[model samples]
Target: MVADEKKIFGHPRGLPWLFFIEMWERLAFYTMLNVLLLYAKDFERGGLALPSGQANEIYGFYLAFVYFTPFVGGILADRMLGYRRSVLIGGLVMAGGLIAMSVPGTTFFYSGLVLLVLGNGLFKPNISVMVGNLYAAGDPKRDSGFNIFYMGINIGAFLASFLSSGIRNTYGWLMVFRVAGFGLILGVIILLLGWKVLAHADRQPEKDPNDAGFGAVAGKILMPALVVGVITYVIANKFIPDFAVTPATMGFIIGMIPVIIYFIRLPRTVSDKERPGMFALLPIYVAGGTFFMVLHLNGSAMTQWAADDTARDIAAPAAFQQDALPTYYKNAGEDVPRPAEANLVVVEDPAVVRMFGQKRMDEQTLAQITARYPELELRDFDPKAQATDFSGEEAALFQFATAIYADGKVEVVEEKDAHGVPSYSAKIPEREPALRRVAFMRKTPGGEVFPTYLVTQDSFDEIYSGYEARFGHPPEQLEPGKWLPVINPELFQSLNALFVVAFTPLIVLLFGWISARKNVTTAQKVFYGLCLTTVSLLLMALAGLASDGGAMRVSGWWLVGFYAIITAGELLISPMGLSLVTKLAPKRLVGLAMGGWFLATAFGNKFSGFFGGIQHMMSPVAFFLVLAGLAAAVAVFIRLLLPKLDAAIEGLS
Candidate 1:
């Protein structure tokens, strides 16, 4: 049961290197992730310019596989490459993939994403084993070292958003992705240079008699799964036209059948003494799986909210800061021009909103307004900035956006410079101009409602300044409101990481005190962690309501609060789960078990994309609430069963 006996910082010296490597890896991953969707639909600005639903769905699928495949990586590394070799290979491959993603071609983009996925698989699980190797068995600092390492991961995540957004907005999308690749390369290089140092960590584990080689396993499961998945997708897409199937989703679902069966049958196949422990862990793992799905969605679903729905406008642009902080408030309307939205901003009456500060425009009416403002360049507008916008039509014939977002209003405060003194200014009559106009169709079917929005000349002048990433256009002259007051969508991606960094020390201290008091148990920490995740989700649900039904963007503080709260849960659960995997796994099957833990994580991660894909059907409040409720249920389950689970671990330990 003895692990490495070395000591550095009261723990293994090599731990820091692994810690930093993981930190950098997460940084690059989160950085590239922060702006991925925005780049996808960027169109002329080096984006694919797809529908939000499609973009989110694809995003979800990508994350799912990225996490899921690591099971295979852990296996390969344990059986053949060993942890260090696997980590090196994964890092190099990921670096190449990230670089390739910047190539700006459709093929290369997919290729890069695929490489990241495979590379992540190889590197993710084995690294955990390395961390364990740094500590002798039963060392108290083992968990603490992991917590420190976890901090490194979050540090990178916290910084990555700034790096990614700064690069993309300031430079270009290509540079942003290229920087992400550089991060991966740096991680690999650092680890390789310190190879001698980390060599004390996990080496190649012995293969079990039951361990089937890759070819035999891949042929038995992978080949058949691919063939079946393809046929199923084709048939679903064609004959059962109503039942469409995505290859990634179907392939993943079917591919898991063999793995699922393997896990289910393992307990029965193993000796009876291990049966109770294995059976007890199943629910814990399932619950953990569900929790991670919601938690991991931060990189996917929550990122969507930040990019599109959350308020991203920085209030004090250079122009407003010239005088005082309240200047933006004083000049609420006069100087703040509401710019018309281009065809590119994915909201209703984008043009009308430009004409009018906050008005409802039917699809058709908005199109007419846009056609009127033909001089404006819609192509340069950032799609992720606004929650909604003016559409191609006036918006009468069809309900273009979801009902939750159809009637949202973004606050516009204009700043007026009087006598060289700046004050808040806004356009307001005795009765505010109707920004949201629900007009009845004058035609025979007049009951059908047609909504109209405006594209005020003032609005147009203001919005165009925020977008600076396009090849020809940059928001160089920081206007009163940073152009459109569009949210810096990527900034929202960092909220969770920010919370992690902010709260990690506190949580670590809390746990340290608890363990010192002889009151802390892994099971208790895990149960509480689930509770925290539930609370975090509930906080997000509250944030949605505060948005006033998608009319206004909530404060970034809301994001900060949720992330901070949830991080406590993450600190408790993620590390504990890793420890449990190491402790409970039989030596002969530890790698596979490690893969199992990661596979559970992969399941949750993939489900995040699935949930993200169907974002339109549910309101943000409801969307987050469902997940919160699920977490609560799981927490309750864990609390009820903590005694038995603890005993099982105690016996094993």
Candidate 2:
């Protein structure tokens, strides 16, 4: 009976274990992500207090860097680390990064973020490779296997916000981050525990004893990269802090010149037999890169939209609130205001600066100022504390009176109501004056000191000018308390995953049933994926237009529909690409090829950021439509290349 139970599934019983591991790992990752956008946003809820445009910029760069690093991780695994060792190293590193984030300081926060980038680079692609390895070359269940794995990812993704939001709301953002880190470590240990069941998946390629180690080859790559990265980092920091991001990304893209040249030249130097497979993988890499650049916007551009533009409801239900103060505040609070004409800028002109300040405030510094605000729950502090000097990080610690504050008395607004609980709406009022000092650099006798300017957002027109060109509106201050009693904005993000988790199994089964009689080629799925992605963007554009170009906040339904449709595209292309890489890669280069695919994704993810950063430079509608057009072009290109792409897969056979 035990043997039959184990043998019940056609594939190895181990598939489910791997699926769960990935799902939880993704759950932790996405949970952190839900907070990431808000973290970048400068609100009372522990945000960095940057303009949405600027925050999105930073978010984009971080994501790009995060996805990009895996190329190195993949190479290290293939040559030196091996799948098991690489996965272990990456997972532990990622876990460490997540753990560090719990500390709640920039030093720790930035370091933790870096660790996440490195850890994800290590853990992400390697496991997918192992999944494909679980099946023999001609296994018919390969597609379904990936579908199951994708389901695992969406499940975790679906739940990440809940886990993150719950911990963050109950404790602080730090707790949620640490939770994600814990999740990564748990995933690694799970893989280790299941090692015996999954041993066949880790088989090494048949190769000469003299094959170069992945680490050694990467050292050849990273050594030069390290030198270049350090030199560029120094130069950029010294010479051009403002331009550092663009330059670094451009440099990373360009720094690959040596690596790209080496890879391109290596195929020529290698034996004729190795040539076809290597070249075939190149186009796949290109496709992977383009797809991700657009797809990964979920973390950056899309998140920005959800945070700043999309309308969300207070997670708590109306029936429960059943009171005026709560309902009135909900309608008039920040993030979502009641007066459409006032809340929505009926622009006299395109470039008017109503809510003018777009500058980002230092996290620790801003936290200090707000600490001086009158306690919403009725507590008092010295007015003198306002002038007290704080070394940024040191200042953030002063918020607790531990003496008067209740343990979790302040309810944090969420994007969704969890565990059937109605989401609440609370506006923790800030230190009322709304006046803050701004420091500027000045040439001093010794070296240089900074000067101060008190630029206040006193009116709608003043705040409006501060907004990035795209949004064409004033800052919240200009429309102060406009978002008071606000509905939970971040919740819309969860709606995307909810749809995915709810529908993925059905979609998979439906597709499987359809393919039963007539198999759907990988290329066909790719085509469908592109179509869905294109439509999703169009949906967004339509929503933007309906909002009358930021003249009003559109209904939340637009975002829901957009995500649902785009997620369908994700189901089609994302995992299929993973499965394809594993299926087509030569055994020896499997890790490396997988890494190459990740490299493409890294570039694409960065592209997502790049677009997000510059989005304010143009109208949101035009910006989205431009991408929609790009997707359509890709669809056309894929259809044209389908026969060749199909043949390549066959030739691989």
Candidate 3:
């Protein structure tokens, strides 16, 4: 139980306990996050099958609310619950959310997301505050401790990408959620076991006259924000329905009115001695928010690029290789093996084509229809078969067919015969799904028929047209079903965490060496981080150029390079921001200040979604250029404000 009895790699004994506790929790968190958008938009995998824009909006709102709740969590921990209890509570709730997501209904799925948001609010900021508490004021080890702590977060993230890939591929998506849920449960158990060791880091709730009470904050800031959000939703949908921003996003932005006003006025409530430090956090919040706006695109725009525009034909670990989908062949080399021609059936029926072309049915809807028609049989649509009495006329199908979706998961549409007894059509793959168009349909040896699509000639012309181009080889064809194994797009996210783990020690040593020789302020480090982010975006912009504005898939190395540059930038900003909040804020309000940092992150994450939602509006080159320009502007702004930021830090003990 004694915290000082032993050292953990030159830091407090409690550090390792907290580190692994966080590692497991983050494994669950990142596992879910990295797959969310893809799951929402996927049709072959029993996903929600939403449009890109709607999915991005949902992504933005979910992240925004997830971070936004930390504000309340921090307040509750400061005024009532201690850090340990909050962490435990948050961990358990998050586990439940993950489990709930394993259910097959949108209702359950959305409900699970809400639980995750609530649990994370309680868990995220408080655990970080505890890490800060382990170090004394002015401790030189504080930054390094946070860096180690940040490494724990990335370690989990790193594992999540691979674990998710393996699990989702082998066992399927729902199993991935179940496994993530269990991972969280294990994290909670670890925390319970280490409770005594973490005691020294837990702070008792204390009251200050200047501190805002929980009820007061809920009433003044939270309630008003909710009211504004509802009003904005209504107004946007009613009056500005065609506005570029979705109603939900519009509501989120306008709803920040109360929260923004409260923060702007927060300094006035604190004593004059503490006011400067509080004021200083405003710019830091802006910087943190801006930095994450670009960084978090890993789950949104960047992942989309990886999935669609980047070639994924490189060899992968044997264990990680998955059955390739029709989507994979879109931009693949002509040499990639395709299914045998005899195995494929071409559809000439426009009715069947339109049916396959519709948006896919989610599991929830499929379940409902199956319940309604207990005898409905699942069958694959074969246009060439005339033995069946059913006709391919569009209007005749309109009366009986409730819904039809791609893939075998929920591929039933109730059809009525002359007796009005309900039956179901066979499940068939979509003629055209997302980015690819069906060139042929394949029937597996097991008799499961599905459509396969390939890259358009335009894509081939752009990428392989020039035999002497950067790729350095002519396209070739291979025997059917002979395609090489390649990694999934989601797995690319692991690169960031891998780089973080690899680079953290180097970054720490380099910073340590520099600090020994000169006074390099934290603000200066953050400024440099922003500069690196700009460069990362520029790398992606060049990638866009290479891909000919997404006319063809480019090399996966572009994504690798992007992640490498951004990982370095992330190490500079993210952990430092966490450490900076703990150092600059008044002692009694550290939890609240930590919450504020997350709030800024929430804002930036929403903007990430915003950019992702609109990604198709501009060419990929222009899109990356805009983000790079934004990062450069933020870096310059931070440079100009460095003197004041340094003075504020110096003002601190």
> Model 2 residue 22 lDDT?
86
TM-score to native of every candidate shown = 0.75, 0.74, 0.83
- Over 148-213, each residue of candidate 1 has an lDDT whose tens digit, in order, gives 888888899989977876565444567788899989888988898889888888665677666566
Candidate number that wins on TM-score, 1 or 2? 1
Candidate 2 lDDT, 550-608, residue by residue in tens: 55556778888888888888778887888778766666767777777776776677678
Error of 3 at 543 (Å): 0.3
- By summed lDDT, which 10 consecutive residues of candidate 2 come out lowest? 349-358
- Candidate 2: misplaced stretches above 4 Å? 1-8, 51-54, 204-216, 223-245, 262-274, 314-487, 516-519
- Report the lDDT of model 2 for residue 70: 72
- Which ten-residue region of model 3 has the weakest summed lDDT? 394-403
What would the TM-score be for candidate 2 when compared with the true structure?
Answer: 0.74
Leading candidate by lDDT: 3
